[model samples]
Target chain A: MAKVAAELKYSAEHEWISTDGSGPSVVGVSAVAAEALGDIVYVDLPEVGSTVTAGETCGEIESTKSVSDLYSPVTGEVTEINDGAVGDPALINSDPYGAGWLFKVTVESEGPLLSAQEYAEVNGGEL
Target chain B: MTENYTALYEEHKKLGASFTDFGGWQMPLKYSSELAEHHAVRKAAGLFDLSHMGEVWVTGLEAGALLDYALVGKLSAIADGKAKYSLICNADGGVIDDLIVYRFGDEKYLVVPNAGNAPTVAVALAERAVAFNAKVEDASAITSLIAVQGPKAEAILLKLTAEAQHALVTDLKYYAFNELTVAGHDVILARTGYTGEDGFELFVPNDGAASLWASVAEAGAEFGIVPCGLASRDSLRLEAGMPLYGNELSLERSPFDAGLGGVVALKSKEGDFVGRAALEAVKEAGSQRKLVGLKGLGRRAGRGHYPVLKDGAVVGEVTSGQPSPTLGYPVAMAYVDVEHAELGTALDIDLRGKAEPFEVVALPFYKRQK
Candidate 1:
């Protein structure tokens, strides 16, 4: 019963991206990743001017049991991060695709991104 | 690694719970989401599978006297239908294991300890009992524990007993237990839990676990009782300011250093127990490092083993750190030097090399809004 957005492009690591001609598309953890990570406690978000590359570490996310790295789906300059999401990480559990988006990137390169369905094929089976 | 499964494992799978390997067992982490389940216990009720914890029965003519020499607390005062928490100590006065002693009768007792430390505790008790006359038996295989926690836990338990055509267990106190017939089997119902919520822990035979879980879940449905896992349980206990065995208190650190001196009975009417001399010495003098609560000023949480510094000098190490569920802010427990351990002492935790501001706060970050 988990939702996989058709329009969103996802990474094998579970980060999702939506490309736009304008600068800075929002990035967030996919639905599969949110369920896997359980209740998110704290999120380490990149600053406004920080530069991130494809497959690079953008920030970090903490659950009750462990801390995890947030991989960047595409390379670009960090534009803005979600302060509200950082305060209440539970918002990410509720809506990992909408206002719970992690950070916005300038999209420097057109990197390879998988569809939501593809990500589910890898992680959504037994778990 | 051993891959043991609980009787509730398949039941949890049917409920769509997230499972994780904990201490070599496939345990439920959460049913829906950890945050949601965490709040459910804070606001409503949550059930947990605590079968992984081990239980040992110590019963003999000298059971009372043997426990008196093996553990720190005086156990002779424990009457039937009562439970007391104490630390099993090493000869050097270090804590071997923290356990709850259940006084089944005047001459019998049951000690519940962590699963990982169960074997060690049994061996130590038996070795110490060589000077006395007692019998220590590991009864973990026959007992299965299920804890129902939260505000409405008692109501749900009452309904389950009535609906199952069984007699309800009344007159149970916060740390007391009694026998009851539920689901056509006699079960030991104890009014104790790790979560800071009001709840009960039921010990039933392994064969009746599946049906009893279903029966209780059905009864708890009306009260919005949610099935929680180890994840919510960990966060809830941390918010209550309780220390985990391996994380906060260990064999290396005495109970006196962990801010749990209130439980130590140094002024016993009789002579001392195993760790009496060293504990008395520490009590007269002071502990070098004291456990204190730290509140991070920002969203970035300090992970475990992060250095706690004062004026650019490493003065302490964080034993446990997590963004608290109730406070909605980063909270952690650390042992700092006596000079910097006082409440409200301003400190900084090094988050991977960057200094994050924090201040010492009192324990039990969140209490029931009395």
Candidate 2:
């Protein structure tokens, strides 16, 4: 089981969205996803200014076991990419909810996001 | 489909190991962290439950001759208590399975094959044994294998053995075995391992596995030994440049292509063996593809089935690869066109659609100091 932040909204695909009620929202993989991935070795991020659709794959995450696509949880223009996470992949495993945010997208259309309790249930259970 | 479990399955579950399906067996993927387990093997010691590996017993007066005819290596000449790495090849010279033949006596040998290939290897050996006086017995069901590996492996192992068997543990050379009793149970202590470190593989009965693990774990406690899983074993083998059966070796390629031709004892042996003619042709004409080592230029590691490119054209494919814990960079084993297999050659591994730069380095990116 992994910790789910009550303030963050999560997707079934395991992306967490931290939104301040509009504008740009920071997105990253949830702690549940990061823990399952084991030591993340590389993160391929979508370029800034690129258009991303909700529920679509925008990038990839490579771990020792295998590579997985990083699905976008909202449809918007990629305003910023986390070079820090890209430079150090282990950050995703160490601080998934904080410094490990993948990218930031400008406000646009988005899909249904689950609450902390719902996301915890969706990912097996809370730790 | 339900996957089979090893004798140590309960032990792994008790240790909170995350599970993965490997070669039809429900195995531990990681007990804690793969990197931690890998580093433990390199610095101190690590325990591995290899009960999934297949063990076939070849007994009778013609056992040696049967192995010589079935496998690529000449096993008949191996002295007692010695082991030789060999390969079982189809008549077409394609490798069926790469195995280690341990000669227990003049008429008794144990052929250990990878978990998934064990049944096939056993059937193949039994088929070849029809012409000889040997009996091939699949003893995998009742046997258990545990490996203790690292720099402190010997000292830790010796602490659990009886005083009289202390010399055997200390004097055992690489690739040698000494059968003896330890912790009140019979065990075949083999000085061999997959990790690029000094290690010992203890082969014991299935019922004795738990006790053996307990005793070894207690003795290795001072050495900081951790129970490792297949993930660490895979990364460790990749750093050592060892070929995994499903990855680096397959029926699509011959032993020569994998750079394992040295193990084929064609020059030292006489008489026809399985795949003798096809292997001879390959030996004479030379292999079209060669396995080479690759060092990644960036954080991204090349994975199996990724295309290997040279000058914008595809020349080969990566077989086995991973981010090496010991070296801190990614390393890979790949089969490339013979022309592109030279050392220090600039090449690219296509990760998804992008080509990542790499260089062909020497095999075995890491080797332990003697």
Top candidate (TM-score):
2
**Against the true two-chain complex, what DockQ does each candidate achieve?**
0.61, 0.75
The DockQ-based CAPRI class assigned to model 1 is: medium
Q: What is the C-alpha RMSD of each candidate to the true structure, in Å?
A: 2.9, 1.7
Steric clashes per prediction: 0, 0
User: Considering only the true interface residues, what is the Cα RMSD of candidate 2 after superposition?
Assistant: 1.2
| Backbone collision tally, model 2 | 0
On residues B234-302, what C-alpha lDDT tens digit does candidate 1 reach at each position?
A: 889888888888888888888889987877777772755788888887778888999888998876677
Q: Which residue pairs clash in candidate 1?
A: none
Q: Write the per-residue lDDT of candidate 2 for residues B288-356, one digit (tens) a residue.
A: 989999999987788999999998899999998878889988899999999999999999999888898
Cα lDDT of candidate 2 equals: 0.92
Number of the predicted model whose lDDT against the real structure is largest:
2
How does chain B score by TM in each prediction? 0.94, 0.99
True contacts kept of 2: 0.79
Kindly report which residue pairs in candidate 2 clash with one another.
none
